[model samples]
Target: MGKGRAPCCDKSKVKRGPWSQDEDFKLISFIHKYGHENWRSLPKQAGLLRCGKSCRLRWINYLRPDVKRGNFTAEEEETIIKLHQSFGNKWSKIASKLPGRTDNEIKNVWHTHLKKRLSSKTNLNVDEAASKGSLNEEENSQESSPNASMSFAGSNISSKDDDAQISQKTFEHILTFSDFTEMLQEVDKPELLEMTFDIDPDIWSFIDGSDSSFQQPENRALQESEEDEVDKWFKHLECELGLEENDNQQQQQQHKQGTEDENSSSLLESYELLIH
Candidate 1:
């Protein structure tokens, strides 16, 4: 015998497979009239032949008013990529940041499309070479001069995957000081080497202050200009609507005045005819 209890609904009585148009209408109408309190009992209340779980999925994924269908935008794709990198496979958390997108939808898109695209584009060989070169240079500098600070020139590695790998390797190499020292000791003649790692004080200052340096004055001014334009657009819309309302009120007043004048003229003409 099965360990668990019997199923919630009878499989024969409750419908299965794709939901019809009539089923969608009933589910939407029932939820709109009375909100989804108990999902298990929702199908019974809504007169749906399907199980509660099925009804819930249909409502959440398709029938809900706010559910956004169709293709994802470029901004949405970027957000998904960034959020996935940070949170891994936490689709629900990722979906929360992107309005109208569901966890299931995001998961499907990532697995089916984005993952393949990323894997196909990633390259690892060039990254390993660059990292090895940097490590060797740093070790040579330390062996040649104890007081020297290490410096590395910017690499022209355009691929994001290559950059990521380089960073990972550099971080790991920094953590292993014993390996660095051992490599330095292996050098045939330590005294004969004349490697210079004399990093300038100005370079140190630049590196330390890079965070603030990136937020340039021109970028801030541009952001402010964008905000101002948005405010101006909203104000223009308000002014146009106000003018239209005022014009409508004035037109109504003029029509009322004209009707009163016509009524008075007819009454005066009737009075004159009666006197004659």
Candidate 2:
């Protein structure tokens, strides 16, 4: 294991706990006047008794003027949950996607509020994976614990057939339950007839292609910025959906003239409908 960062100052000497108004003023004032490029020297230079780390946290989480102080907006919270799904426990990376929010604040919010919200939203556990004890003895044994949580990346769920198993296609990557119900409701109720796919060539390629050979629409060149996380997620979802449907069609001998089955085709339509 790597050595931890050694404390810069003696712990007993530095002040701790809630910052006084004067301390806040001093930290903010010093930062504004002479930027906090070097946090180690900041406390001594600013004439504050707090440690450099404390000063940094104070400025970042509480003292920053642009810091959003009120309750998080609904959209902000939703963004956090989605980002968490994409990047587990990567608070700084997640915070980077959300402007004016510090990693510390986001971490606290997740622990205090969002964690419960997510659990309530998706009560899925790893028991489904553990039940397939034959797959990997070690993996299943570890997963059988009560505290075991589901990490849905490439996770599998067993089917009714004892001899045969069905691949779950990493339900997390395909359609996260957070938005799955929402998507299903839209499918069940076709209120919005107006829909279009202003899809990036990169994303549309997976959806519009025929057979195993993937084709880029219009032979369009894909730049780095052409696609994003959500786009990639949908692309994977569509590809897996097609493969799953195709497999079912083969099993049931329900092949049509087109490469994709009816269910996959209808799903593609639904996806393209809400693409915009």
Candidate 3:
């Protein structure tokens, strides 16, 4: 036999494979009325023959109210690809960043679709390069080709124009000092202000000022002094807000740790009872 104790649910008594409609309804109803903290005892209370682990998986992966179904969007696919590259196979961490997506769903999608797509693309690129073998010939053709030269020059000019347009549009949307101050005054939560300004301090130099026109020496000196004061005030606010966020995060982590400990103890006790 294996190292661990026998299964919690009696194989002979419990209904296995796909769950029936009645089982689904009962599980959902029971969980809705009373939460799923003590999963091992939940099946008996809910009149379910399924094991606690099965019930937990069903609720987490399929039956939850907030679970999103249907095809993934193009943006979501891109995000998954980027996150997968950075985090490797840590599906749970990646799922945390994507709301309504479970680790199981992401793992299935990656294995079924994205992985195959990437492999096919890589193979296609390799075949194309192999068929066009000589690097020297390719270079010579490019040097003598008027069409290639024109295409390259045109592409460079178009890329530069696109970049400039994007930069202008981005600058137009950047917050001015007056707008920032007004937002801070309007927001009720310190956390909101912290998130809004959670960027590099150096970017503050690009923030729009009240006056853009050239001014006399005396007026310019006064403007500089006022800007310095505003910068100091913003820095102080950011520091205080950061401290508040840290404290809140610490409290949340402590609570989560305690909850996990309690759940582990409950699960162990339930398992021992089942084994005995």
Q: Of the candidates shown, which would achieve the greatest lDDT relative to the real structure?
A: 3
Quote each prediction's TM-score: 0.44, 0.43, 0.44
Model 1: residues >4 Å from true position, as ranges? 1-6, 123-276
Model 3 error, position 136 (Å)? 32
Candidate 2 ranges beyond 4 A from true positions: 1-6, 124-276
Write candidate 1's Cα lDDT for 1-276 as tens digits: 667977877889999999864466467445544557788898997788989989988877765543445556544565678789999999987766654467889999999877875565354445766755664575465545632222221122223434235443323213122332233333213341221111112222221222111123444444344443323322222222222333444433433343334433443343223222
- Clashing pairs in model 3? none
Candidate 1 Cα RMSD (Å): 28.0
Candidate 3 lDDT, tens digit per residue, 12-81? Answer: 8877888754466467546544557688889988889988888988877766533445455444555677
User: What is candidate 2's lDDT per residue for 7-100, written digit by digit as tens?
Assistant: 7877899999988644654564466445677888999888789899999888777655334344455445656787899998999877665544
Cα TM-score of candidate 2: 0.43
User: What C-alpha lDDT do the candidate models reach, one value each?
Assistant: 0.50, 0.50, 0.52
List residue ranges in candidate 3 displaced over 4 A.
1-3, 126-276
Residue-level error in angstroms, candidate 2, position 69 = 1.1
- Per-residue lDDT, model 3, residue 231, is 44
